[model samples]
Target: MLGPLAAGAVFFPGLFLVSKGALRVLLGWSEGDAVLVSTRLVSSLQAVMASSAGWIISSSCRDVMEDRHWLTEAYVLFATPYFAYDVFAMFLCHWHKQQVKGHEEAGPNGGAVRAALSGFLRREVLMVLHHVFMVAFCFPASLLWRRGKGDYFQGVLFLAELSTPSVCLGKVLIQYQKQNSVLHKVNGVFMLLSFFSCRVLLFPYLYYAYSRYASIPLLRVPLVAPWQCNLGAALLWPLQLYWFTLICRGALRQSGRRQKPPGS
Candidate 1:
């Protein structure tokens, strides 16, 4: 648990820094302005990440309590409300977006609102599916690891997770190469490394927990330690680096106009 917490702590700061820096760069802010805005933004994002991590840790600790039956019941009780809040939040976002655009006049051949809504809905649906799959896969995989039969299966799943990010990186690289943007090329490389680290180190631990401990009879013992959690969170460093690289690349590209230099 300490591991995970530490990882989260370390990772969130870096993630916040990268995100804030990227935003500043994109907006063409000077270094001083970027640093100032990034500082505030990162601080706010850090608070949110810390709060979320606390809730998760607390929930895990509750699950491991000695009063087994009561703990299980408590877990369900708390989880329901938490999940409900998430659902409500999603709805609120959609409603807010609709309200913001409700008064706009529809233009000729303009389906901007529909297009935006459709894209948002699509992305939301995919995000939900991704979470569902993560839970479903992690749960069974963890059980299998605990039972000593999940090694290979977990390996495969880990590979799949790793592959998805690699594919994403590859696509980014292909685009970068086509655009001949040095910044994007560098970003692609960093992102590839980031994804690789996540797939290699983080997924294995996740698989171990999901396969072995999620369903374990004991309520108090965390499958993994906080330190391990922190280590997992460290994956964010590479992720942040990758994101920064991408942002820098995009900013550089957008800041200057260049005509196509040569024929294919």
Candidate 2:
């Protein structure tokens, strides 16, 4: 556990610095842009690692409830530090953007730090809460709460990250003012589909998987399952629904623009 934690501690920041430097030198991106892109690049890499681990664990577990995969615990520990790193990375990105926008020019350095922090927290409270819960609640629950059962479910949960790369790509495209490009449009479609299928539909699929295994009806599985399992799913699904609605709205706006007559 300590080993993976130490490795992640070094790896994420190292990769971020390397990525930031490369983007600055090779692409001539501004500090703010490089910070933002590097953070997203790190996120995409983590998503791939988590999703691959999920796939491997999920595929190997024949018994959904009883089967155990060694990678489940290993990968979770390795990736745990990423949540903390990401929060700091996000703040750095936000701070650089504030500088780029000249918000810091109006205030002393100390004041700018406070203002940037406050603005970042306000803008990102939901996401920050999500990360906090993962580190505070989900980490122990994943490793300790289950008493060594249900690795399959955890693997499936990790698989929810499958949408992240597309989401990252879409953000980068928009940041670069290429939202009208074909790549952005194609990526938007992919993001919507992946987010919906992997995230929004995931909880239901978990219930269905268990119901089939237990020989119970789909709706009844929730009642029959452990309270903790039901509670976790209940807490998580609503967030996915909310995010999905936002994604849908974005897709609709993009579609509306695409259909606008030339020259408006």
Give the best candidate by TM-score.
2
Looking at model 1, residue 24 earns an lDDT score of: 66
Q: For model 2, which pairs clash?
A: none
Tell how far residue 60 is off in model 2, in angstroms: 0.6
lDDT top scorer: 2
lDDT (10s digit) by residue, model 1, range 1-264: 234434544554465457546866778754433443444344334334433433443344433222122222222222222222333334334544454457543242337646655656675764444345434443333333234332332232323232233334444344335445675456455645644554445544454554455554333323443343334335333453454466456546644434435452
- Model 2: how far residue 174 lies from native, Å: 0.4
10 residues in a row with least lDDT, candidate 2: 100-109
